[model samples]
Target: MSAERYEYVPHHLLRRRVRDIASGVEGELMAVINENVSDSPLREHWVELAHIRGASGREFTTAAANVVPA
Candidate 1:
């Protein structure tokens, strides 16, 4: 980081994002929610999913393991 490498937004000032629909922006936070497998009978499939999806997924199992489901 260097002051000499300046560009537009040249001098900083904080700005809040307008979230209302009337403000031409969606008001809700967007996210991709993962499915809850805590009560599933086919919980083994979910653990396999964690492996197939690699490092970004649920890599660690809990203390109760299969008893607590996926």
Candidate 2:
């Protein structure tokens, strides 16, 4: 299915650098969630997501907490 490109989401390995970057950001945000305070680049990205999605990080966290992953 990966020969060209499917119309739906594709499952594939992430590049190491990209995974590392995401892991770093996830760690920062998770730290904030656990400790309720910490400086993190994710704070800025979270604000951006809130601005674009018209939703708050608290909403995201709540939703994520309820997810039933495939």
Candidate 3:
């Protein structure tokens, strides 16, 4: 068996990542919080932070791979 690779990145940081990736541009690249795949609290938090950092809109993904590389 192989050990799992887990990187400890806090939710707040992830929010920032989304904003940075979007670069304040409007389009599919904007950050988004999908209620279907994401819980209320998590989704709300990310959404709030994204807007706070001038990234109210950005692509959303259930996995980290969706987040743009910083």
Q: lDDT for every model?
A: 0.22, 0.20, 0.33
Candidate 2 runs further than 4 Å off: 1-32, 35-59
TM-score for each candidate, following the candidate numbering = 0.16, 0.14, 0.19
Worst 10 residues of 1 by lDDT: 45-54
- In terms of lDDT, the best-performing candidate is 3
* Number of clashes found in candidate 1: 0
Per model, state how many residue pairs clash: 0, 0, 6
Ranking of models by TM-score: 3, 1, 2
Ranking by lDDT: 3, 1, 2
| Superior candidate under lDDT, 1 versus 2 | 1
What does candidate 1 score in Cα RMSD to the true structure?
A: 21.3
Mind giving the per-residue lDDT tens digits that candidate 1 earns over 1-70? 2222212221111121112222232211212122244444444222211111113342222211111111
Off by over 4 Å in 3: 1-12, 17-59
- lDDT string for model 2 (1-70, tens) is 1222112222222111111232122211221121222245344222111101112333222222222211
Rate residue 69 of model 1 by lDDT.
Answer: 13
lDDT of 3 by residue, 1-70 (tens): 1132222344434434332343433222233332232344333322222222333443433343334434
TM-score of 3: 0.19
Q: Which predicted model would earn the best TM-score?
A: 3
- Cα-lDDT of candidate 1: 0.22
